[model samples]
Target: MAKYSEKASKKVEQAIHTEKEGKLRTGTGKKVTSRKQAIAIGLSEARKEGAKVPQKKD
Candidate 1:
């Protein structure tokens, strides 16, 4: 199992809350309507922040 850092987890939580409150928007100015997409965005942000997130394994 891969482990995500505290910061990454926090970002994911924030994204979830933002999505639930209809406060999340994409870069193209479109509203985010999916929880999974919000989570992906959060993880991407966490990666940009240098969090210890592992790459997806397939």
Candidate 2:
């Protein structure tokens, strides 16, 4: 199992919340409707902020 930092978890939570509220968007401006995508976005953000997240799979 992969371990995520507190910050990464918080980011994922926030992303999920925003997605449920219909306020999350993708880079192309499309509304995010999938839970998996929301988590991906959160992890991406966490990675950008230097959170302890695992490397993205190809």
Candidate 3:
């Protein structure tokens, strides 16, 4: 199990909320329908903000 920082967790939660509200979109401007995709988006944002997120898996 990979460890995520508090900031990362919060970001993920916020993303899920946005997804549930149909406000989350992908880079291509398409709606995100998958929970996993929402989680990925959250982690990506967290990484950009310098949160202590684990390295992306290959």
- The order by descending TM-score is 2, 3, 1
Report lDDT (Cα) of residue 54, candidate 3. Answer: 93
Single out the weakest 10-residue window by summed lDDT for candidate 1.
49-58
Decoy 2 TM-score against native: 0.98
- The better candidate by lDDT, 1 or 3, is 3
lDDT of each: 0.92, 0.99, 0.98
TM-score of 3: 0.96
Q: Against the true structure, what is every candidate's RMSD?
A: 1.7, 0.3, 0.6
The residue-level lDDT of candidate 2 at 42 comes to: 99
The local lDDT score (0 to 100) that residue 46 gets in candidate 3 is 100
Question: Which one wins on TM-score?
Answer: 2
Error of 2 at 39 (Å): 0.3
User: How does candidate 1 fare on TM-score?
Assistant: 0.89
Candidate 1 runs further than 4 Å off: 56-58
lDDT of 2 at 40: 98
Which 10 consecutive residues of model 3 have the lowest summed lDDT? 1-10
